[model samples]
Target chain A: MGLKEFCFKKSLWVFHLSAGSCNNCDIEILDLLTPRYDIERFGMKLVGSIRHADVLLVTGIVTNKTKSRVLEIYSQASKPVLVIAIGACPCTGGIFTSSYNFAGPLDKVIPVDAYIPGCPPKPEAMLAGVVKLLKSKNRE
Target chain B: MGKKTIVPIGPYHPLLEEPEFFKLYCDGEKVVDMEWETGYNHRGIEKICESKTFEQVFYVVERICGICSTSHPFAYANAVESIPGVEIPVRAKLIRSIVGELERVHSHLLWVGLAGHFLGYNTVFMWAWKYREPILDMFEIITGNRNSYAMFTIGGVRRDISEENADKLLKVLMDAKKKISLLTGAVMDDPVIHARLKGVAVLTAKDIHDFGAIGPTARASGVDIDIRRDDPYAAYEMVDWKVITAKEGDIFAKAEVRLMEMFESISIIKQCLELLKKENKGDIKVKVKEIPPGIGIGRAEAPRGEVFHFVKSDGSNSPVRHKIRAPSYNCITTFRRSCIGGTISDAAIATAAVDPCYCCTERMTQVYDIKTGKKMMNAAELIKLSQKKTEEIRAKGDKND
Candidate 1:
């Protein structure tokens, strides 16, 4: 199969990483797949394993303990993968940024393609970020 | 017989991100045994509360979890208020009930969305959340901030819901009632959802009581203990609403209980709004002096379940120790035992149904040898790819310069 056709056809399978978020972002990520947004209709499915995913959507500030897992998940994704940091927490460390426990923003560990900003970014904005990332072909 | 394989489900799993480790002994499709490790998100919130004054500590305690932020402060405030033996203004009491129940409305709607997604019912997830936005807008109008509404203060709340906001709230509540009616019937009647969730992850009533399970978990298992009723606070004493409970102790039952509870929340909101209209104007929050030095225990029914906040004040600027016990903490205790015999696919549903909050749950260190662990490629290759990206970014920056 031609490379373009293959990438387009497979569509990006998202693996949501909770770098130490407030579960609000994680819940919104789940909301995108629900009937309203119906992300699956756009050919994007939330995958369980990073091995099978094409994009990594991370939420929350990267803490000392969770940094390794974030790096590990990023490593597991096959090459030409995109990482979308969702929520204000991951983008700028949000409220928890002041805590001594937090390591820093998610970009400190791996490359981030886009930032979806909100304490917990609304489900629509999250979906919009994914669509923008996919069309740009910037990850590869 | 084939050897049973042990699969470690987290501490850093995508399906379940709450910093919990679930070791499952599985023989192909069937899980034989399970073990779960927790305490990953432990931030010593209680320890931090030790030095703050009662007033400053109130705000700090609320930061424990956004989903249950209101409940924590309300409970802590109540505990301290009770110590002073202060009689909160009648209006303040009713407003507290209204705000607490309103928080429940948004929280339950949020949980409904999560429960739907966990079972792969994306349609229900979206429908529930779409309806939830209006309720949050109502929250925003009343308390300014939607998620962390600092409405509750010691002895009373910070502000009152003006008559105009009350009218808007009544209209919004009416809309929410219609949407919730449609959703409850849809969730209860959906075949795919029922097949996946019914009778899955059963926790018996006896088991619930023994494990110190609170809120919806205990109620789902038929344990009739809602702090709103047992120990009335705010205007819950004046309002009339029934505590919703179910006997199933499974995911399906919990969803059903939450859906039905939304109706009760609507009932309380209507009552409170009516009271606001009748009362017109009164003191929203009473002025208070410094809280005496002592330890206080505040308990309330958060949307998820019972939220307990233990605060210690040294008569200082911040709390000396503020321990927060989120409902899922009690629920997670049951995971290791309940997950036995379930499949890897079922693990997500089982875990997510408890509404486990990973951001609040602490994490433990996970060390894996790079070369031997499950890897699509080696560390060197990934590092090289990262270095290449860095070089490209530098080149782009130089070009711009």
Candidate 2:
């Protein structure tokens, strides 16, 4: 396949990583894949292995204990990867921000591309972010 | 003892959103030994109780887990109210029942979606979640917050459903019923789903007794135990609903039990809404009074299963000791028995099908890259990076054009 054809035709495989979140954010992320938003229409698919993914959708605040696991997944992805932070907690630490257990914001660790803000953002917003990211990537 | 390969699922596993960990020792593909470690997501909520008043603690407890947020406050309020002998208005009880069942409907549907994702059935996952939006919209209309509906007070609910809201709820309920039927039909009839789930993780009725399981896990295994039916609380006694049970303790049976329970929840919500219109409102919340110095236990059927809250009050403004027990805790205990002969992938779906909420069970932990010796991206940074890349690609496209 030609370079441009390969880049455009190959769908973006997204891997979801939960640092620590109430299931609210996780469910909303899952909802993006559902028929209402159908993230797949934009060629966004949830991948089981980080090795195959182009986008890493991380939810929840990254605490001290889960630090290694989250970093491990980000390192596993191939180059030119995009990351989407999915909730208030991960974006700005939400309600659990100042707690002694937590480490800090998600950006403190890896490069972030989009922030879908909500106590937990709605599924539509999540899909919008995914499509926006893919469209931008294809344009490049 | 022979050497066993150990795999740790969660603290950052896909089966659950929360951060609990399960270390399973496998013999080839079969899980031979399983033990769970919690405390990753625990914010020391009980510790927070020491600084807040009884009224404020009500709000704090509600933040325990978003899915069961209302139930935590409801159970705590029940414990605090009984201490003062404060009589809750009948209408208020009906309203609480309505809110509780609505929560159950959304939570179970959410679980159904997660189960579908775990089983490699993305269509069902998407369909179930799309259907759940309406139920959550109903919650937003009534209580404001979609996830943690702060609806309860010490003696009763904070908000009352007007006739207008009730009518809207009825319509929503009708839509939910139709959508749920389509979703459940897809789950039951799909050969792919049946192959992945049916008879994959078997838990016998006897296993339920041995593990001291409660809620859907127990019900699916023929252990006829429902806290609502056996120990009637709030308006559950007045509502006409049946405790659904399944003879087969496999993942499919568990799925069936959860799907059928949605209908029962809808039925209970209908009865409560109807009762609400006929009854006159006297008081939505009783006056805050010091709870008598004694320990009390409050149990309610949360969406996942029975959530038991034990409070020890020393006639003080706050509880002396509070122990919160989520039904998933009991259900996770049964995983050893269930995953013994299953493949690694089967274990993932089966554990997820149990609807484990690790946030309540464990504290949050940070995950890093084991191979690269670098930090992992959190949700916000990932979103930003995704956006930036998209923007850069779009700019290049415009220039080319």
Candidate 3:
């Protein structure tokens, strides 16, 4: 495995983007850091800037106003980037997918490594999803 | 020292999880003026609620906010129940109250943890959230899931809190209460917390009334307007409790109100369980036969504040217009009252004082230093400063020991 790939899987610094989500998935993402879920043991951290991120954890369904901005932030991230779409909203737009303001799912606009499906998936499910995403890309 | 700068924060930035932008003008260290840009998070939930069947709209509004998921459904159920002139079973009322209060406990604990993180108290954040786990477990036990609890329906709730689960629920509440007391005591007794939070970003009683703020934001300023007391929905009227309020109207006051309310929430739920066993028992839901054409207004006290849902039905399965108002609608506006004239360090917490439900409220904030023409502080840096002060205080305490 390459140096970049090894580092990315070891300590995934994720920059989360919510296109037009209800904030459930976002909190679930934050919940991962707490003692209950303890994603920090895996070296996954939420960074302030997209520039520092190794993985982009996108939540919410993409909305019209946030479409270009999402792409811009995605472009800001450095290479060897792994984009994991969290929750049902970003993956399938969930219930709000059919709404007019939505610009379809995250995969249509950016490459997603994996999709974790739940209205707001449990923290255990989310941690499992990220682990699965890392494992799948181990061959790469 | 003289040049004014605009500290622009997000259409989408890291300090916030939502997509509202704020232009905070500052002269050196203190903020002088601020302007906010919204519509980034607006996905037309109200517009969509119009199309879905009345039964389906409960699910729709529940998704409006993951934090206060039960609040929307609680208000919507009340609105829909009023429409058909159907009365919910007493057992349903107690269960609704139990779930709603449980949501309050979890929500406030989440806020306490976030507030601690923003103020640079990671220990408090960890501890508060550690306690918060059982509340979510309680939610899972009762409602079958965490976050968007699909328990509430039109006439009543979908799930019933059976006799078997009542003992387990009480045990969890007792456990949560003990844990919360420890967390709140740690916050209240810490001198570093007082130094960092007290008298900072004070919103006066006048500012609260002028901004039309509700919930903890208003209560922190001594504005006594609890919808639970005023308009009384579910089992709020039956329960004996006082609305927690503070007169200081500062960041500390907001924290104090929420902390105290956490205990109150526990007590209320305890009373609800006892009541469920003794009096309010039987069918959990009533079957409705017909829908009448009229406008119905339903309001419930959410963890944030009053959630007012207006359902305008023209004798259809789906309403013509279903207008829902989250507590943050009025609460977020109070930033105009609180953020001005405070240091850039206080800017993040002051705006977050309302516990704004962009979900992650204090995630993204940017402050520009005018003379250098460079970004002064993002939300994380501000948090670091808060933590630094705390660490210094702990060092001083260690030396004395």
Evaluated on chain B only, candidate 3 has a TM-score of 0.88
Question: Per-residue lDDT tens digits of candidate 2, residues A27-64?
Answer: 66766677766777767787777888777888877866
Compared with the true structure, what per-residue lDDT tens digits does model 2 show for residues B199-244?
Answer: 8889998888888888888889888989889888899998788999
- lDDT score for residue B147 of model 2: 76
lDDT per residue (tens digit) for residues B7-123 in model 3: 898876777877778899999888898988666566678778888888999888888888989998999988877877788888888889999999999999989988888888898
TM-score of each: 0.81, 0.82, 0.90
Which of 1 and 3 is the better model by DockQ? 3
Fraction of the reference Cα-Cα interface contacts (below 8 Å) that each candidate reproduces: 0.22, 0.47, 0.65
Clashing residue pairs found in predicted model 3: B14-B363, B14-B364, B15-B363, B15-B364, B16-B363, B16-B364
TM-score of 1: 0.81
Any runs in candidate 2 off by more than 4 Å, and if so which? Answer: A1-13, A51-55, A74-84, A107-116, A125-140, B1-16, B20-23, B189-196, B363-401
Ranking of predictions according to lDDT: 3, 2, 1
Q: Write candidate 1's Cα lDDT for B261-368 as tens digits.
A: 999999998998888777777787777776656777778888877777676666554556666667777777777656776877787788777776644444223334
Docking class of 2: acceptable
* Highest lDDT against the true fold, candidate: 3
**Interface RMSD, one decimal, each candidate:** 3.0, 2.2, 2.2
